[model samples]
Target: MASTHPEHLSGSTADYSVAVPKSMFPGLFVLGMVSWTLVEYLIHRFLFHMKPPSDSHYLIMLHFVMHGQHHKAPFDGSRLVFPPVPASLVIAFFYVFLRLILPEAVAGIVFAGGLLGYVFYDMTHYYLHFGSPHKGSYLYNMKAHHVKHHFEYQKSGFGISTKLWDYFFHTLIPEESHPKMQ
Candidate 1:
């Protein structure tokens, strides 16, 4: 399903499209969002945090910009919502990379879906720290998990919208540290 929240459809601020589509089929868009979330979670927990070999200062710097800074300043609102220019360039790069390996139509659809997912994650992460979720909902739980990543343990709980990826990868923190949904 497409996100019911308006924030997921925009970027940077409420006044702009940023890197998103003006309108999209909700089902396809939601699917894209979820699939991309997994990809995003994986990339953040692994590739972006990779310990590059010696003589790879450029890669380490790139990682710092792409993700490390977020860990360093998790509550910074401006940093929370992805800046559109850099996000668009990254998305385009992914499109081209996938295009070389998949059929055109499939690649286009998946890329579109993944882009929508990234949009949702950026917006949701912003809200989790700034706007707040309902008192007792999955979003509420997710917000707590994210805050833990920032305040207590930076190494796990990488999932944003859901923890399925963390669970699957055995990167979930201890239950005592995570707490039950409020």
Candidate 2:
């Protein structure tokens, strides 16, 4: 039988991280998660979708590596989660950027929070498609929204884990098309 996996995704499996302590040690991790969610939304809507000059095929490839692969292979279950090494690299890069602008401790905390948020966003996205979120749950709705982006409309519904930004920015899908459960 032919495999139903998404062909564009990297074939390497993600090495998931171990659980951090739930106490203060993990607080930065949690903060990272939340901060990353908003960052994810912003990056998805603006940077990921940006149409660059046609002359620079390299730029196009970068975009594809960052996001186009996911759009092309939306149903690819394995591609949903960000691999740990790349994710850590991205976090470190952003942490340094934040450090330059804000106080060291504040930047450190915010960056940590953002990374934690990213983890949750990645897992939630993967779960939306692969895991079973019961009908009428928030996650179920998010799954529907994301599926819509893949199948019906790619121009909108970029928010996967949360619609707050989509709603705020007027990118949300119309209700008439994807109706909510009663």
Candidate 3:
């Protein structure tokens, strides 16, 4: 397994602190986690999956850098998680953005939640590819849905942790009709 450490994410000289009521942090964390699902869905559907023009080499390269590589090699373990270097940048951006738009305590809580959400999403994504789940189990179904996105429905089934957003956005992949095995 490849290390997901954000060794390159260090060296930031900024010092920041936010004070939040200890009692509220848990709820705020949960909210942050929940918010991450929507964020993940949006980024995946709109940004990562964006179709670059066939004639634009730069756009193609950008697409591959952002996500095309994963589609091309879905089982590459090292590439499965967001490399900490880039991920830290995005995480910082979100933290700063949240702090600017909301109260510091609220922002911190939500940011933490969102961060946890990203961790879960990455881990679950890896598991879906590499872990074997029992048939008819939740992970099994999730794995099936994800595999379909990779192999069959590239334009749909963008949801990984949950399919709620796909249903909400009407991007859910339609079930295929198959002859029952004898």
Candidate 4:
């Protein structure tokens, strides 16, 4: 059945977000955002860092194009984000999956939150590559963590937007003895 709320399909933020009770909306939004972090960590660790069999050149090249290229050229501004076409497909998959499990209005707000989380992840990934984050700040710590992952601990510290999962999964990079990255 078509949702009577045409605004649900429209890009109007207020319409879908307020579909739920005021108290429930905040928690659901945060849940969706945090869920994206889990997705990001899992995708990076399991897919992006997957080891292809040595005999299969096709898998090796595919891995390189999917993620190895980023490790090879971290500052390639052009490679900072998933290409729009591929990204849209992934986003659609998530939206459809979320809609299947949650009520229409609730799913809309949750998807909105997850979408925002994705944006933050991309921006943070780009900044960590190029920005000179202030020392002793969160971004600086994240930059140092990410730099360590790139240059040294490639097998660990998979969390890019936040290290909360790395800590939980026991894959957090060990504390650096040297001065943190500038």
Score every model by TM-score: 0.70, 0.72, 0.82, 0.85
Better of 1 and 2 by lDDT: 2
Best by TM-score: 4
- Model 1 CA deviation exceeding 4 Å by range: 1-31, 52-63, 177-182
Tell me the lDDT of candidate 3.
0.89
**How well is each residue in 61-167 modelled by candidate 1, as lDDT tens digits?**
88777777887887677677668887788888888987787655556666788887787787788888887678788888888888887888778888876788999
Give a tens-digit lDDT track for model 3, residues 119-168: 99999999999999999998899999999999999999999998989999
Prediction-by-prediction clash tally: 1, 12, 0, 0
Task: Give the alpha carbon lDDT tens digit for every residue of 84-177 in model 4.
Answer: 9999999999999988887787888899989999999999999999999999999999999999999899999999999999999999999847
**Backbone clashes in model 4, listed as residue pairs:** none
Question: By lDDT, is 2 or 4 better?
Answer: 4
Q: Against the true structure, whose lDDT is highest? A: 4
Compared with the true structure, all predictions reach lDDT values of: 0.75, 0.76, 0.89, 0.92
Q: Could you list the CA RMSD of all candidates, in the order they appear?
A: 13.0, 15.7, 10.5, 6.3
